[model samples]
Target: MKLLTTNTLMVLLILISGYGYIASCTHDDIVPPAQANPTPVITRGENVHLPNATGVADGDTTKWKLDKAHSSVLWSTAYVGAAGLLTGRFNQFGMHDVTNAKMLKYPTPSRGQVLPDTSWAFYENDPSKIYFNGYVQMNTSNTGEPGRDSGCILGTGYYNTVKIIPGYQNLEINNLAKIKTTKVEFDPLSNDYIVTFDFIWQGSLASPLTQSIVGRLKYIPKAAVKDAVTGNVLYSVFGLQLNFQFDCRDFGVTSTSVADVIDIECNMNFNNK
Candidate 1:
C-alpha cells in the first residue's frame, strides 16, 4: 500500500537524484458494501455484548464487508508500534485475488533496482467476490558499500490467483494457503481473526538473468493488526504452516508454465478474538 515501484529505495533516490519515475501509487478506499447480510464472517451469537448507543460495542461480530464501489474487502489487523510506523489495520487494498495473476511481494533486499507493480482487480460486480493481482519483488545485500547500499540477489516475478468461494469453502493455495469451510467454525483458542496466505519463489539459478534470487517465498504481514475500534493489542502475522508441505519454490526454477495457487480462509472471532 506504499509505492508502486518494487524498489522503495530507488523511489527515494529518484526523488533526490531526479532520476525516478513519477510516483503513481493507486490505493482504493474500503467501506462496507450494501448486501443482504452484513457478512458471513460475522455471526449473531459470535459476540454476546451489545451497545445501547446504536453503535457497535467491543467484540462486536460483523462480517468483513466489501466496498460496493471498490468491490474489495476491508481486511484489518492490530498493532502497537512507533507513530508513522504502525497503523495496525488489516490493510487489505483492492487486490484482484483471482484465478491467475501477478501480485507484489515486498521488502526488496536494497533501496534500489525498483521494478514495476501490476495492479489487478479483486472484485467487479458483487461485493461478496474477491480477487488478488500483483507482481512479487525481492532483493538482498551482497556488497559492503558505505552510505548508499547496493548489490544482492534479484528475484523473478511471481503471480497469485485465489478465489474467496461464495460460501467460504476451503481450498489449498500452493499447499500453503489452506481454506476450508463446507462448515465454518470459529477458533475460540485464538482471539484474533485469521487469514492465511503463502508466497512461493520461482527463480532460476540464473538471473545472469539480473534477478537471480535464491530463497524460499514466505508471506509476512507488514500491517499492525488490532481490535477494530480500539487501537490496543497490536500484532503482526507471519506464515506458521510453511514446513507443513513443500517449501516455496526457488525463482526461475519454479514451473511458471503453471501458477501455484494459494487459498485464503478468513475467520473472525468474538470473545477470544
Candidate 2:
C-alpha cells in the first residue's frame, strides 16, 4: 500500500509539470497587434515674388546689358514629308544699343497714362518703357554639316537660291537679320509676356522682308549677388526666354524638302550696367 501511494503522487507531479510547459510554449507563439505608421510632415520654402517696376524711384535710370556668353538663339525646322528636325544656331548675334531715355522710362500718370497695378512686374506697365532690339548674322548659321552650312550662306544647292547681291562681297552684310520689339503685354493667366516684334530678314529678295511676329516671353528675375567678404552688392542678372514659330517661305525659301514652319527660341541673359 505504501509503494502504491508513492507511485500515484509521482504520476500527479509529472502531469502538472507537462501542462505548465505546454502553456508557456503557447504563450511565446502569440503575436502582438499590428501598429500603423505615423504621418509625415512636409515643409516648404518661402515664395519670392518679382519686384514691381513702378516702385522704382523717380528718375531712376537703370540700364541692362546683354551677357552674350550666357545668351543663345536656337532654331529648328522639320523636313517636308520627312520624320526629322534640323536644328541650328547663329554663331554671331548681339543686342542693339539701348539708352535710358528710350528703354527705361518712368510712368507719367498726369498724361492720362495708367499702368496696370498687377502687371507691373518686370518693366513699367507701359510697353513703350521696355525696348529690345537685337541683330543676327545669318552668314554665321551653323547646322553641323559643312556642306549644308555653305549652302545656307550662299543660298544654293539644297537651300533655295538666295545668293548675296552682286556687289556685296561680304555675305554677313547682306544676310543680316534684325528684330525689334513693338509691344509687350502681360498675361496674368499664363504668366507670360505677349511680345510683338518685327523680324527683318534678307534672302534672295530685292529688298529686306519684314514680318511681324508675336512670341511668348518668359521672364526670370534673379536677386542681386553680394561679395562674400565685403557684403557689397555686386550685380543683378535677369533672363528672357522667347519662343515663336514662323513660316520660312515668307522669307523666300522655296525648297520642297525644307519645311515652311520654323521654330525659334532665344534665351537671352542680361546684367545690370
Q: Each prediction's Cα RMSD?
A: 28.8, 12.8
The per-model lDDT (C-alpha) reads 0.25, 0.61
Tell me model 2's lDDT, rounded to 2 decimals: 0.61
What TM-score goes with each of the models? 0.21, 0.58
lDDT of 1 by residue, 54-117 (tens): 2112232321211212221111111123222111111122222322232223243232112221
RMSD of 1: 28.8
After TM-score superposition, what is the CA distance of residue 15 in candidate 1 from its true location, in Å? 88
lDDT of 2 by residue, 1-273 (tens): 999999999999999999999999999998977887564442222323332344222332254545566788888888667898877887656555222232222243432112211221245344445556666556556788877676542223322223434332222424566677878886555556788988876565666788999998876765687899999987777787889888877777776757878898888775553
Candidate 2 off by > 4 Å: 1-62, 97-128, 152-173, 225-234
Best by TM-score: 2
The candidate 2 region of ten consecutive residues with least summed lDDT is 112-121
User: Each model's number of backbone clashes?
Assistant: 46, 0
